[model samples]
Target chain A: MLNIENLHVSVGDKPILKGINLQVKPGEIHAIMGPNGSGKSTLSHVLSGKSGYTVTQGQVTYEGKDLTEMAPEIRAREGVFLAFQYPVEIPGVSNIYLLKAALNSIRKHQGLSEVDAMDFLTLIKEKVRLLEMDEKFLYRAVNEGFSGGEKKRNEILQMAVLEPKLCILDETDSGLDIDALKVVAEGVNSIRSPERSFVMITHYQRLLDYIKPDFVHVLAHGQIVKSGGPELALELEEKGYSWVENKQAA
Target chain B: MTTQTASRYTAEYSKIETTLPGGSLPWLRALRSDALKQFSGCGFPSLREEEWRYTNVSGIEKNLFEPRLEPSDNQIDKDWLENYRLADCWQIVLVDGYYSAEFSVLAGLPENVTIKSLKESLEAGDGQIEPYLGKAVGIDEHSFVAFNTAWFTDGAYIRIPAKTVLDKPVQLLHVVTDPNRLAATRNLVIAESMAQAQVIETYVGVDQAYLSAAVTEVFVEPNADLTMIKLQCESEKAYHFGGTYVKQARDARFNHHNFAFGSLLARSDIHSDLSHGSECHLNGLYLGVKRQHLDNHTRINHLEPYGISRELYKGVLDGRARGVFQGRVVVAEDAQKTDSEMNNRNLLLSNDAEADTKPQLEIYADDVKCAHGVTVGQLDEKSVFYLQSRCVDEETARNMLTFAFANEMVTKITQKSLHDLVLAEVLKRFPQQGIMQDWL
Candidate 1:
């Protein structure tokens, strides 16, 4: 479903993602683990088509189409979703309104009529129940005055609503408590299907316990030095990235 | 036309002063003369003046318009009047600057709510009208104000009796229909002690190349509550100058909201006074596009102890338009326990668009809480990208973001229909700034 071939990326002349090559088939769950400044977040941003990133070399293909040249919204409508590391606080904009606009935009792009208010309410109620999120959160401004756990849960709720073909979770479990993390992980687990792919990025191995990955890649110094199964995450959690660092230094 | 310019203004001032109707008292005549003298002494403010630094009124001076002597009765369509009516309120329409009794409905007013024309109020010998007429906003402080005072022919007068609560809002529609015409209109509102009322004064025009000068005075007595909404949506070639002066007595509450979305060149002055234990909230939003210029100058005077005031004004400028905001809060001596906060935020959408914001606070009271902030920048790129990542196209994202910024003030409006109307007008004026070109 997704392919990255020798993708070299830079931020203001400093290389961040150096020759990253990865492939993920449908229904596959992939995890990218790296230490601090391992270009984990940068990879997610570039995949989401964020501006200000210089793609020096290589190409990215999504579903056999050129993904690097699409605008952020076009990529989003094409079923590519990125859960931001830090959710933005948009004051005075209601969460429900934003969700409705986003859903309608994607629907319109797919040659479907926009959903009415009643239908939208009915649709969101089911998602809210599945995610165990309170309906009251929809009335308030998006991410404004939200607690850390609420923000993370809100991102999961958005993912459930969007139902993207390829979902990239960036540090989704960073600020969540045990209960919140489990709920978020369950939310992700429920959306797992054969036709959809998941790319989870994290610095810790705890989130992997809830939704096990099929493939785990170690990223160090802007390059993926090792690829293994779920046991690699446990190995890094037990030992640390110091071994990877020393190997890169050697 | 240099020195003779003074005589020209003086002649225009004297010509209107002598023609005031017979119901006007001698004191009003003296006040008018004094205001005219002050105006003549100061003449027109130049761009060199610090207060007028960003605004250039050279065009206003070059094309001096003569004030209309009598109201015109041409092509006043009934559909247009109906279109201007606010939902579930008494609609008082003013045609070509004079109150139109035929189109106004005052029969369903509450028992204690008194609505009348200014001319009728003056002729009825209502002693309550004189003291608060020009007391809040002095004409001597501004040249256009003086010009309005010296020439205003007719205006709306509203008075809510003591302890009365008006359920329905009162709508005052000022419509200018004559092309290349100039009219000076005024509105006087008095909310008695413990009374509550909401008033919406809208200035609109159909004719291009016209000028409308308006001044509204509001008095909130002790324990009274007043909410005033001022909307200016004039012609594209029109020029507008409006002033709103408010006074809050002891323990009174006053809220003023101004929305400016039209006019080629528009300036609004809002002066609010909070007495002992009084409170005031002044919020404004202006959208300027396509060479439009909008300026807002607001001042809050905190007098006596335990007074409070809060102000927030935002502007969105695009297509070489300019926006200026100058907000000042003064806490006087003995006004201890005063709390005041003011903030001005602007969004510049185009390269040539400019925004000037100055939030100033002067405190003489020792015990007070006062702070002011100003920010001028483009839309947040991260926020834009965040919205876009949610499947909203760039145009929709930008429009939603800008609307959200202005909705901070629009949500404060209690009237739903009026709020929707103003929102539609704002959307039409801004047009999503081409962010939706691909989708369209």
Candidate 2:
């Protein structure tokens, strides 16, 4: 559902992504693995049209439309979701309020009726059960004083509610314990469909064990240097990123 | 030679000397005469004074709004008045500073709790109100108090006897009609020992320019509780000055909610003196637009040990509006173990809008826990982005965050009818198109 052609991006005067190209078909799950400072998070932010980033060269196409030209909200209304690594703590907005606003906005954009309060409550209750969240969490302020794992699970809950066409999981597995990781992975796996796509950005192969991807790509020095199958993650975990660096140097 | 602003008021008071209230009582006459002299000596407060530095009253000084001496129902709008009065409460209506028994509802009032006109009290004798008229607030506190003291012709007098509890709030409605009309009135509220009561003061008027100067004094006896709410939705072209001074006895509790939403220039003062183990809370929300200037001043004094006070005041300024917040807390030397917290926050929605905030804490006690915080800025861009990322457009996101900021104060109101009323007033101050009413 997403096509990147030699995407070269820069933040301010410093260039981050030198030349990167990737393509993911419908219903495919791609895991992008990289070491620290490998431009993994930048790729996700740039794809979601966050401000303060300049695309120096190349282009990104999503669902046959130019993605770079749309605003952050427009991209969201067009079924693009980015689960942030550090979710913002909004002090006064309720989690249920944001979820309903988002669902209604997307539904309105798709020419569908807004969900009634009763039906919306039922839908969120089922999703909340699947994510193992406290029922009281819906009434609390958005991510305010929430635990790290709770925030990650909330992101997954949002993804389930919006049912986006392209889900960009930006380090959703970070800071999560084993139990929380399982819950989040199961939440994602349950929403998978032939029309849905996912780009999971993670640093460890441990998350790959829960949700197997169709392809694993190793990103380094602002470029995708290696592309292989799910077994490639295990190979990197055993050999370490230094092995890939030595092989690229050679 | 003192000041032109003060001299003009002296001249205005002279024109209405024979028309003032409480002429039969020498004590009341002497108080009015002394207050007039004081007002003349100091004149209108100057910007050079610390308390009035940010607010300029030259606009008010230039105009002459004579106090309306008699009730004039010619310009009253019945339909418009119905919009502001709540249904589930006892209503006392005042039109142009005169008590209107025709518009007041006191039929189902409980026994031993007196809610009557100040005019009636003054005419009958000194038995009902002479003891607590000026006990809480001194006329020398400011020029506005002095003006209201010398010029007030009529007001509301409420008294709840000892051990009595009121199930419903008592609404004091003050409305003005004519242009350049002055609605100067005084209110006295007393809750005896172990009593509980709620009082709401609402000020509204026609579209013309007018002046409303009001002073309300409250006395809460030992072990009593009282909640006072002041809702000022004056005409956009009007000017307003109101002061609420309270004295809390040992173990008494007092709370105030000040909502300032109207007037071209408005200023509200809420001050309290806490006795041993007494508690006080002051919460306020001020919204300004279209060149409106709103100022809020609050003070809490802890006199004995174990007293507590909490305060939060917020302002939202748009268009070319300006908002000012000044808060002061004083802990006496004997007020050991006093715990107090004060906070002031402001949101500026436009480049032309401005907010000025000052918090003063004076502590002579060694064993007290007191903290204060202040902030003045636009909305957080990160929070806005967070909302926008959830599919809400930028304008809608901004509106939502702004509403949420003000909603914190709305949620503190326990009275459902009053809460809904205040929320509706808040919604009217914002752009209707930006906020979707159905979703809220």
* Model 1 CA deviation exceeding 4 Å by range: A116-119, B1-6, B22-24, B110-112, B432-440
After superposing candidate 2, which stretches have Cα over 4 Å from the reference? A239-250
Q: Pairs clashing in candidate 1? A: B395-B435
* Residues A107-182 of candidate 2: C-alpha lDDT, one tens digit per residue: 9999999889999999999999999999999999899999999999999999999999999999999999999999
lDDT (C-alpha, whole model) for all candidates: 0.85, 0.91
TM-score of each: 0.96, 0.97
Candidate 1 global TM-score: 0.96
- Report lDDT (Cα) of residue A105, candidate 1: 80
After the best TM-score superposition of candidate 2, give how far the Cα of residue B204 lies from its true spot, in angstroms: 0.9
For candidate 2, the per-residue lDDT at B352 reads 98
